[model samples]
Target: MQIALTKKLAEAVGVKAAFAQENENPLFSWTANWTKVWDNRRTEDMIVLVNNATRFTVAIYQVKKKDLKNLEVMMKKAISNTLLFMNINPEIVEEYMRLAGDVELVQNRGRQTAAWVSKAGLECSFYVGREYNGIEKMFCDTVGSLINYNHVNITKTRDEGFAPYQEMINALTELTGKPAYKYRAFELSATLNLDVYKAVRRIIVPANLSFERLHNVLQTVFNWKNYHLYDFAIHQGDKYDPAIRVVPNRECLEYDENAVLMEGHTLSEFLPEYKHILYTYDMGDNWEHEIELAQVIEDYDKESPFLVEAIGQTPPEDVGGVGGYVNFREIMLDPRNPEYKEMKEWARFWTPELSDWEKRPRVIRL
Candidate 1:
């Protein structure tokens, strides 16, 4: 093992020097899929396991001698920074950080402390385990097993199915003291739609996570693809088959099985063409004319008041975004702006346009 790392270290130094200099000093010595070595006068190989795809196994090295106490502090900072970049939860990161002060330097038997000077110097190795059990395992075994056995419909009856999101929300609320109304529930409901969310929530949250706790977990794990928005993804053919199908809410109202279209179908499969069903929105001529026209409505002194009501309320600091008052001011003050115009278009596209009389100060009832 030591011989292999020595050879790999030579190769790594060669590669590093080639990048910008013919014989520049190597910053660190490492091997791919094996031990990393530190070299000065003597050499020490630090073995590391890199099989966990989601994390990096860091091998620290030094050319000069150092005491264990000083080394521990350096290792702690290095561990904290590395974990932060890997996007591990701050709480989990903190747990690992506490272990930093415990790292000890293995020393030779009968060697005096000062006599134990390292020619190759001090070495530290850390293996960062995967946070969410590697991608393949979670998808294939955990989620796959869920789909294989319970099926999507099971999401409704199973107590485990809907509980995680609630638990996470509850925990975050207790920790942050944020109000229920402060959260962006539309996003949370969207997260509950994914299978991975339930699995991770089980690991992170208490048995009964409140709304705030759920929000924090979502904020932490939003980068994972399983929690990505949209029910159907590019690779849903095998995974989302009815054999393993589950709805977002277990109580989800079913559409006519015959009326519902599956993976490969186009927009025509669901909606009629008269609805001007564009899979994506159009951008074309009179686009500027469309803008000028909206400005006219704003100038007439109509629609602005009710627009205020439709926006609901401002998002809290925890739920930062353009909310009711800000959006209303932006739209009314400059209705012709492209962004506000796009917002208006989306309102019409996603929901029906309210009639002048129908426009209430509060969100219009469905």
Candidate 2:
């Protein structure tokens, strides 16, 4: 299959193309600046053609009739890998796919093809067949069209699926305009409960912090081991209208399937609207914290999460949520109790003193 593709691609592009396995990187030096073509056969039985000068790549998947059911999956993997190889963000590719009107490529059949030009001027094409005639020309035409394509207009037209993301980006851009020396920061107090006896930690985090980063800050400030699953649920009014749940990739099944990814979104986007949020950590323990945005510091230039104040010690992780923590706390406070010494030692190890709080703010790197 790969040999045939190599021969056909060579014939169509009028260049000597060779069959290279997925892991193989063949060296080629060309005199022309914008006409270099490279071919590789992926381990998944797909042929990838990359033109370095044009910043264009094509993934050709030769599917058998029996494998038609898995064509969409194959195409997605191929496209994703191609984009990764081309140093393109999958999100941008997703936006392009949405604009191109065939995100899943489910309707693509034998010899069907799709092409998209990225915001960074990279052209990507997907072909579902062995036929290579005119494929090069198709890529060339797509690149030509891309040269004059209005990406912002395309984004506006296909703005339905990505409204929330776009809104978040716009809000962030507005908030962080011009990248001044100081950044807008959020002073948040995350309390385990509203009761007087509950554990509480006051933190000042950058407005651009993502939910994932918030999780890490909570873990560090509270001195809790990151051994459990967690999520953040935003609320409006009495009902939790729209929440951004951030769970470990493996534990996503535990929460609502429609939850937004916790990585891309920044705290600034949601904190301004929904000032109150519920952060649940260790699902089994049911440790819920009420995260309130106490204040927004406009002149703060810190890059990390800073612990301002802490009241009471964070319960030892896996202590079975609030109820278990209460029981454990009771046991630790009583020296006569059988678990007192062991539990106290455990608490001392995980809980940090007020002076021990690192002065450096925690920064979330994407």
Candidate 3:
């Protein structure tokens, strides 16, 4: 795997004067490395800067060199994660990202080993000890997972849905006696209300996830992409208040004056306040998910979010909402129906993976 360090960190590690330039540069040479190459980042994978160190680890990244074309974006994301790990405000992180590499950073006590993000958007842990071999092991283990596969940075698992960067937050916990940021784990039951299909999913998510990401997790649960505008809101006495809605970034949207946006305010604060939230996606189709807070895990230390239960098939995106989907299901139930072939063909356009649309309802437990 290829790793290019900032000139300063390369110096701190004495990598500058180590091997002769004409000789073997094992740090950048995939063949000279002793560790097993689980994935490949043969060219350039990461731009890492770690002034933070603990008895356990040093901050490092494992970028998937092939998936992404832009290393600068990965670099900026790593820097933002580092700055955020140091308890810098989200707004300030954005400013730092805007400034880009012009900003010089220093090591902070907050992050004993700082932050890193792979091109696959994965955070890493480089375990170490006081012994010489321990440091060597850390380097080898960190680099070994750089093969073409996602041995290090995987966002989704078979059951665990959207994995948060909990490792980054808890990197300093053992040394400092607490995580860099406190996250509350929430057990949520999301039921998509349709005219016929009652799709349900039980999820466990960290509250620190932004509204935008929470929307994404819901999208995954329903097998729908974020193709339309969506928002999270609580029910008022008569109507759901737009004033209390949490939408995407204001810069990206023509936002309401009163709607809460991501970053400046994240789900960390708003999610715990209410037991029920209405997640509405596709304003035209108007698909509503009633999210009921089933349980709360205080001082949660789990590595990622997951889906514990799933039931019923979800209609594909833009199926004309409740009424249209009901008609589609009716047609599919009878093979002799004239619209059966045409309707199933159309559903395949939205869900390419499903072998048969006329099959039984979807059910999952994990």
lDDT of 2 by residue, 223-265 (tens): 6777877777887644256455555464585556777767567
Worst 10 residues of 1 by lDDT: 285-294
RMSD of each: 24.4, 16.0, 13.2
**Top-down TM-score ranking:** 3, 2, 1
Instruction: Using TM-score, give the best candidate's number.
Output: 3
- Model 1: per-residue lDDT, tens digit, 26-71? 1111112123232232543332211011112333333123222243
Q: What TM-score fits each model?
A: 0.18, 0.46, 0.54
- Higher-scoring candidate on lDDT, 1 or 2: 2
Tell me how far the alpha carbon of residue 343 in candidate 1 is from the true structure, in angstroms, after superposition: 47
* Native-referenced Cα lDDT, model 1: 0.25
Report, for every candidate in turn, its global Cα lDDT versus the true structure.
0.25, 0.49, 0.49
Kindly list the per-residue Cα lDDT of model 3 for residues 14-58, writing each as its tens digit: 444232222322211111111112243234333333221111112
Residue 233's C-alpha lDDT in candidate 2? 80
- Residue pairs with backbone overlap in model 2: 304-361, 304-362, 305-361, 305-362
